[model samples]
Target: MTLRPLLDPQLIYLEPAVRAYARGREILARFPQARQVEIDSHWRNPELYRAAAAAEDWLKLKRDVLVLGVKKGMTLRPNGRSADFIAPSSSNGCAMACSYCYVPRRKGYANPVSVFVNVDDIVRSLERHAARLGPKTEPNTVDPAAWVYDLGENGDLSVDATISRNVEDLVAAFRAIPNAKASFATKWVNRDLLAYEPQGRTRVRFSLMPAEMAKVVDIRTSPMAERIAAVNDFVAAGYEVHVNFSPVIVHEGWEAEWRRLFQEIDDVLTPAAKAQLKCEVIMLTHNEALHDVNLAWHPKGEDELWRPDLQERKVSEGGMVNLRYKVAWKRRWLDQLLGWMAQTMPYCTVRYAF
Candidate 1:
């Protein structure tokens, strides 16, 4: 068996001068055969460029293609509950084949890591944005000392770190700014990242699910044991290690599954990690399109995830259809999980549960 890099992009594309940059060169060195592609714009009129890649190769393209270009739009939007502000995107798409991931919805059949090479612009955006907020005058669950910026909303930096210095440079950028902390969630464990001292200016939230459910859906991501075990190590290093009980999947024997999962955390978590442990609980919200997509690539997972009777349809502002547990089922389910959490992991504080 071949040991693949945490992020193994079979083909890499850099936009002219973007390949000459330090971080760009770092990424190129890791994948020697990565070829460069030329496009007049990073975000527009690139259909001809994309048409070169075959539709049958979508999943392979998702896990394999890497685009390095400028992030021209530097606007930061308000992301209140998750973070003080949504930091300008560092990258888009992920390599992991998590069947339940929402990223594939927007990308249709093809989804791949698009690494932004204009890192200095991204850092500058964060610096300017953080400066405008000044001090966080009020209290919020996101962070008490520093305004939190969600850095990896669309991609996994843990996997991204293996391919480029984009994640590292962003973490370093956040570390220098006193008024904000860089926050991102990951399903993979990159222990090499511990070397970067966040200086209490970054938060690494490990997204989790029971091992049984994850094995069915998480695809090539790090093992649940690896993620749980890394918490103590990350805390021992300068990073604030947090847990994300995210995209919570409810199915047969869910209670027993969750109980065992929480108990495992309770058993292995070091005291230092426990003391600072804060969590954000997000319930699973599935979508019809994503369910259909999963059916094609990972049908086994869809058997557990696509439960029509338990879910209710929701229409987002973008006119996309999403499904969450019906209100009645959700109320009962949340109460049940909360009880289990309290009983199994008393030391952890749930900053927010939704």
Candidate 2:
């Protein structure tokens, strides 16, 4: 694969508290050419936040800005389906601009990748948390042998690996944890992570969609074909690989397109990958705030996302008003998609669906 810079920030927002950290110093040395601004707090950088919204091009701002801070609070929350718990974020935001991304909603106008420098602290806390949970006493769909942790709850670890050692550190930390596994969903195909040597301690869920839909919705992330092609290789590299059919967009002809996508996966995956493959199927859920944001930066992409006729209003657990496919319709669409998957890739297991 041809080498390309994973990140090229024109401006670096530095949190003074983190500059003394080894990780922070390494990042500064890596990007000496970029303009650096000292900020009081990573989350409270109003100037950068406003600039992100006011910028003429949203995607450009995402590519040009970076935030570095120390994650002071290390709390792992319960997560039943994707993992046993949502691990403390090693990072937040993402370089990729997927249209339906929820990360940007909380940050208002801007959502550039935020790298947390206190990774050693985060890892130590995770070890303590895992020790408290002890070994798994019951088998569940998430993992039969260990408690699972979603290490990239708010960001893409594969993309984060490009700019920081957090992914490497977290994966390495999990290797020694006897009863816990780290997992994250990502759209990027970063071969650098193949050297992390997870030894089945990390689960990398490659988020996927139909090729045509992905071309518009995934935005700046790896092409659908590349993600599919990398699955067997990642599995070979000792990481458990899973597929995520996330934010499954509902539209006319979506089923036929999905069928083609399933066929492509069945044709490309090696027997080894197919044997271990498990999937999480999540239908599209859109927020009004995100819809308004997309209109500013990527209006055309919204055409595939902001469909209200087939959707109904939803109040998210966080109390945000959102839109999702009505229950009856979503069930029907899910059933149809799963039926096709069973026929095309019977070996693949559906770990969870929503």
Which has the greatest TM-score?
A: 2
lDDT of each: 0.81, 0.90
lDDT for model 2, please. 0.90
lDDT of 1 by residue, 40-96 (tens): 654443552364245355456666677777787888878777677888887877878
Candidate 2 residues 216-266, lDDT tens each?
888889999999999999999999999999989988898899999999999
Error of 1 at 236 (Å): 0.3
RMSD of each candidate relative to the true structure: 2.3, 1.6
Error of 1 at 29 (Å): 4.0
Displacement of the residue 231 alpha carbon in candidate 2, Å: 0.2
How big is the positional error of residue 94 in model 2, measured in Å on the Cα after superposition?
A: 0.5
TM per candidate: 0.93, 0.97
